[model samples]
Target: MKVRVLVSLKPGVLDPQGRAVHHALEGLGFAGVQDVRIGRTIELDLADDTNDEAIDRMCRQLLANLVIEDYSFERLGDGESA
Candidate 1:
């Protein structure tokens, strides 16, 4: 089985890296780019019988910083789908 985890900053968190990228895009002449926020995606290959509760625990314990970020996970088969 495959799992995908998305980690992102919570609302109201300031993202300086995202802001810098947005500015760089404007410098490169890309218009209509309103805002940008950076996040992370992690992919894991796991045993077939892994459960959602365990995945959630993994996210909370290691994948995401609960104080300032939020995360979610999706389980996939041999062919990935979310």
Candidate 2:
């Protein structure tokens, strides 16, 4: 099974990297941009029998920082990879 975990900073959290990118875009004459936020994607190829509970534990325990981050996951088809 292939699982993709998306981790992002929660609302009201500061994202310096995102801000920098936004600034750079404006510098390059990209207008009409309002704001920016950054996030990460984690891909895991696990055993077909892996359960949701185990995957949730992995996110809560290690993949995400509960203090400032939020995460969601999707199960990918068997043929998917990147």
Off by over 4 Å in 1: none
Which digits, one per residue and each the tens of the lDDT, describe model 1 over residues 1-82? 8899999999899999999999999999999999999999999888888899999999999999999999988876665553
Compose the digit string of candidate 2's lDDT tens values, residues 29-49: 999989989999999988999
Report the Cα lDDT for residue 44, model 2.
92
lDDT of 2: 0.95
lDDT of 2 at 48: 90
| Clashing residue pairs in candidate 2 (N, C-alpha, C atoms within 3 angstroms) | none
Top-scoring candidate (lDDT): 2
**Residue ranges of candidate 2 with Cα displaced over 4 Å:** none
TM-score versus the correct structure, for each prediction: 0.92, 0.93
